[model samples]
Target: MTAPSRGGPAEAAPAPASAKPGSRMFASLAVRNYRYFFFGQFISNSGTWMQFVAQDWLVFHLTGSTFAVGVTTALQFLPVLLLGLFGGVVADRYPKRRILLTTQGAMGLFAAALAVLTLTDVVVVAHVYVFAFLLGLMNVFANPAIQTFVPEMVGPERVANAVSLGAVNFQSARLLGPAAAGPLIVVIGSGWAFALNALSYVAVIASLLAVRASELRPATPQRREKGQIRAGLRHVREHPELIRPIVLVGFVCTFGFNFPTLLSGFAYNVFDGGAKEFGFLTTAVGLGALAGALMSARRRSSRTVVLVGTAAAFGALEAVTALAPSVWLFGALMVLVGLLSVTFSTTANSLVQLHTDPAMRGRVMGLYMLVYTGGTPIGGPVVGWAVQHYGARAGILACGLVAVAAAAIVGLIALRAPRAGAVAGG
Candidate 1:
């Protein structure tokens, strides 16, 4: 079948060939609803990152176990592995804005509950586990909805730009949140960080409310039917272009994106660093990711070469990072890793959304989020165990090796396959 039109429901006339580069780079923000969503995500994602740092640190403090940290990460994503497809189905059948409002509220409540527990000094490892699981459950629903919602805001012509800008918002928060968390945890304690995160949700909720409902280029809701989930599965199964990149993402995300487990180990164990160093490590990655996002924003299309090439580069950087002799050197490598990571992710994301039918976008993205994040449950524990026994370097090395191997394999398959041009076309 031919690819879906890149123009969306509210798609505007294309810019002229002589249009300025800056206009192309910031094309998506021309839509009013996207601008509100952008600023709101900027604030909320930063708070989310702050809580991430605080939560990991608190778990380590409470248990003094890296395995516990992995478990926390696992609990947070396990629900996505289990229920994400259903969440996509829900996204397909419902208004994404309404789904986001409900899911965002639930997540805020979970953050608030964690904050209360920590503030009262009654928080324990088990409490963190439970709350992490609850948060994961909320994400299972929210992630796919949010992913599909972006196209509705900007229309398909600018979806790639919008996705890259979303990454800019996220990485901006990633840079700020952990940087702030280190000092905040030192001075005020982790509980207040959680409280701040809970309050940050207000920004997103308000933005969702502020968006003009009539302005949204909403997708046609899928009719209720038996075997809907299977239909989604079959759609992906039959489409090599969609499934191939997603398969590559699954491998990379499972093995390559375990930075929480790896960086935590590096900070506490290898570098003999404290909360500040850990925060810096994360911030370095965020900085690199921001650069990558900006670069991706300039691109008009996603291509298979960009996706596979960046994945390979990311893996090579991870391997080099494992062997860095100093904290500064390791942090520097992390920036490169972050840059490659965002490049690969944004390219893959745009490839999937741009190629799929809008009616099926939610389910495809649901699968995308599932493959992207849901593998955490399996990889997190294994990486944590490697760090605990084999050392942080070994754990990082393992991740790099797997990612490189996956990229090589995917690249080889893509090159050797018949109709490679058709499959690799973005």
Candidate 2:
């Protein structure tokens, strides 16, 4: 893709024969390929979040067991543990657009299936578990491919802008999805939410079809050598710079910010409210996350200081939220916690994408996703059990403690890594 140097819509477009792609926010939107994706993804992400809220509600209502909630959470992410590494390999070998189309369609089907089951009053815990697993399996391929495809939409120089724009889209969706879902669930029921999610897939598919491949940047060359996956693993282990952030993100996501599972407990035990209150808790977080994304978009930093800072802030926020002693205060603190959580996550994602090379970007991102997904798989169960036995406040406090501890350790490690390098060279 051609990089536009001067200001204009052309700057966001793929390198043209006559123009340079400018480095600015919304730069990728100048290009038709990315513009389609940006809007499509925005719509899709909103619908996905709606489904997430509905599905969790469905499972909780069906079982009334925290363990079941955790299991559902685990099922959605467990595939990342089992197949994320290989999924990266697949992304490298296949055409990303094709992969995305297939996966998005599959995910839509899964959501539709859930809607059918629930609407018919035949939905069972096992069915939810099965659908969660199926969705996770599809994500193993979809997530990595989508991340790797960003550079193709706009070149490396404008990557930060592209990343920021994408973050904005996602954050906006997150904010809108739950807010809409809460009312929709009460009025029409969770089945409608699922149906809306299914319909959302069409937007993404249409966007994918409308984009021209010639406008896309070249794909990374596939590595077909034996033990290639092992080589990828070795590379991550050997490079602390790459692996360090991934580990930190995992820790924060798992221990600090897996709130969907705990939110129900907080609603019932802590706040003594219903589904509306629970949904509002999520909406509060979404609002905070949107603010964080917009703030990050303004900065021009290579290091994700925002991410680390947010991790620490999230831990602190969680702790404060846990001590609110009232529903209103707790909801208010959750907004701050949500903002910190998104700030940390989006910054981390941008950092990872910025530093990675195209050849191994898919695999490297997959590793990042693995740590993220892997963290949830383990953390969900632990957090769920904690809430079930301990009071909701205690469970949240434990999660906060884990976040603070992880942030401190990772912060020290990040600081030390560079000093260690300097010392060795000296």
Candidate 3:
């Protein structure tokens, strides 16, 4: 599909050609528009990670309840479970740049508000829950805009590269955010983490402001229509390849992706540690994930076998990690868990985007994000219960077993379905 016409400037501007398809791992960075978006979002994403670590740490500290941490996480994703589809429709109908600005600015405000509350020592656990849910509401729109915007910034030929590199950006930030938050949490308070996150959004806003509209290969805006949401779902239902990964990811993630819940429990209970220890464990996962993302960037295709295999390995590793007798062993095992988990995620993301038609891209990605992200909330409290009663070790073991089962089930289904040819070029 061709990008929507930008008229005068577009006519004069050079074609938004990408680097030699899969020849380079960072090919998408060659595109000026994508570079601005990437580096800016990198800064913002690191801050988001900081908030995640601090928020959960604070909640765990406050209630001294594993279930409380789970509940807080569940609240954050509840909006995505409920209103995610409508966000897709909005993404299709509006300019993504505008949606991003509005969402980013609003998020910064929420972070600043949280910071003020925490710094003044007036904050309650309820305040964090409210902010997390509010942030999810923004993400419902921002995620679709961000996910679908990649192909526009760089052409279709560079989508896979862009996606992988984007994962690299995120995972690398994971290494930084938690490690930095560790010391920050000790020196002053968690309030400073929130404050930095609010400031970080400025980088994103400025990057968006600097983007050259004419350089963008924007999609044709979908007109407002009554049955659009329904139509989008039907589109996915009719496509087996799309539906398969979406379902598989939901299952694996629902049980296996409760990292914060599981890790926090381990830090507080099993490992008998504090914020710095929690940060160390989380950063270990990020270290492995960064490696996984970098390796994924060098490849060209997203295959079902790879996705299923990674999920299986990730689950097995999580089970082993749960049994670690020492913090050192747990951290070491977590790196493997992080690596395999990220591989599965990047594969699923690449497969969905590569297979969908541009017209339905936003809506389809919305559904994908709904399942991918929404699964965590449904599982968090349940997993927390296992940790609360059985032990943190039990929670991780349960997640591993479930992920393995899901992979086996999905693998059998994939064998019976029509052949899935790998998406090449991009």
Candidate 4:
């Protein structure tokens, strides 16, 4: 479990401890703990993406209806709405490494279950729904813990770099997973995709074990409140600056960027293509997202600037993408959309972590996810129905309009709030 002390596929040598501060994008990678996690997560995320692609394909094979695909996505995200706030409370109370160890293992088992069902030809829409829900529940906790863990491992000063690096890792998986899965699913079947994901957990678990506990910065110490969840909500409600971006992300996730509903329709109907085209579209997005993350990594300004601008731009880009004439053009536009999305996402993520107290990090991140992923449940059915009735292009246009409006409203509010405060002070 220990990070390999020397050069090994699994082992990550700690970066030289003595690198003077204010280095570059991968500076945090030099730190032993972060290096271990970075590489481990990189390996595991590839499998995760593969599973994601396979699951989507399996569900589509089972039902062929776009709404059914939306439902599977909905079921997977529903837990974030219901339990994400509470999951944060759990993350705050426990040793994050220990919590991750457990959750990651549970997720692996869930993947295995899906694999069993698929391989045995017993996989049904209902079975996919059940497994997706279980994984969603696990994610309500795992997502926040992983988000907060970066700051815990690398501290605040290097947090931007760490966040960028994490985004890069995620994008790489997004790129590599679907590209590989498209062929693998064709050759072996969806079950192998699920199986690969189950095995990927081993990398993360091993990295967690290898990490030195003493290296992790401690979470904040707070008196355990009787209703901690409510307190967290109250905190967010009272702090628009802290909560608004998360709300924006959720809005985008649900309305502007419900890919399962939006892009699936595009792939199946508008483009007249199948899994390969879909995978190509997602891979193109990953490429753009990787670009966005790299851009954010090099930024040296206030986070609010990066977040607000990128989000607005993303919305604009999505609107244009909705009108793309050809499938190739549509795929190309998606790359831009993906790039802007990651720029906004990574900046928002780093900001939330940077501003939060360690004790409340998990809870705060949980709220972020609740707003981000939870929106899917609330918006999926609506978007799905829209796609069914109106047409996929109209549905996509609507999503884009919603995103643009949210950004405009929120951005104006953010601007006005500061002026209002200044007046009150005067």
In model 3, state the lDDT of residue 183: 83
What TM-score against the true fold does each predicted structure earn? Answer: 0.90, 0.85, 0.89, 0.87
Write down the worst ten-residue block by lDDT for model 1: 1-10
Compared with the true structure, what per-residue lDDT tens digits does model 4 show for residues 1-426?
Answer: 132121111112222456433456567787799899998898889998888888888988989985677677778888888999988998888778988999999999999999998999988889998998899999988988888788778766667678888988988887888779989999999999999999999999999999998888756545667999887777667666577677778777778767767787788878888967876786677788899887766554335655777778888888787788898999989988988888888777766665555666778899997887788777877887898898888888888888888888778887877621100000
lDDT by residue (366-397, candidate 1, tens digit) is 99999998888888778878989999999999
Q: Indicate the residue-level lDDT of 262 in model 3.
A: 88
Best by TM-score: 1
Query: For residues 1-426, what per-residue lDDT tens digits would candidate 2 score against the true structure?
Result: 353322111122222334332333355577788899989999999999999889888888998996687688778889998999998888777888999999999999999999999999899999989999999999999989988887777666556556667778988987789778888998999999999999999999999999898888755568577776786677667766566578788888887777877788898777789878886887777777777666555444435445566788788779777778777788888878877776677667766665555666778888888887677778877887888898788888888877788878877887777531110000
Residue 287 displacement in candidate 4 (angstroms): 1.3
Give the CA lDDT, 0 to 100, for residue 170 in model 3: 91
lDDT of 3 by residue, 1-426 (tens): 344232210111122455453456787788899999999999999999889889988898888996687678778889999988888888889999999999999999999999999999999999998998899999999999999998889876667678889999998787788778878998989999999999999999999998999999887898998999898899888877788789889988888888877888899899899877887887888888888888788766677888888988988888878779988899999988888888888888877876776777788889999998987767877887898899999889989999998888888888898785366424
Clashing pairs in 1: none
Cα RMSD to native, each candidate? 3.4, 5.9, 4.7, 7.1
Candidate 1 lDDT at 276 equals 82
In model 4, the runs with Cα more than 4 Å from the true position are 1-23, 62-67, 120-125, 221-223, 271-276, 419-426
Worst 10 residues of 2 by lDDT: 5-14
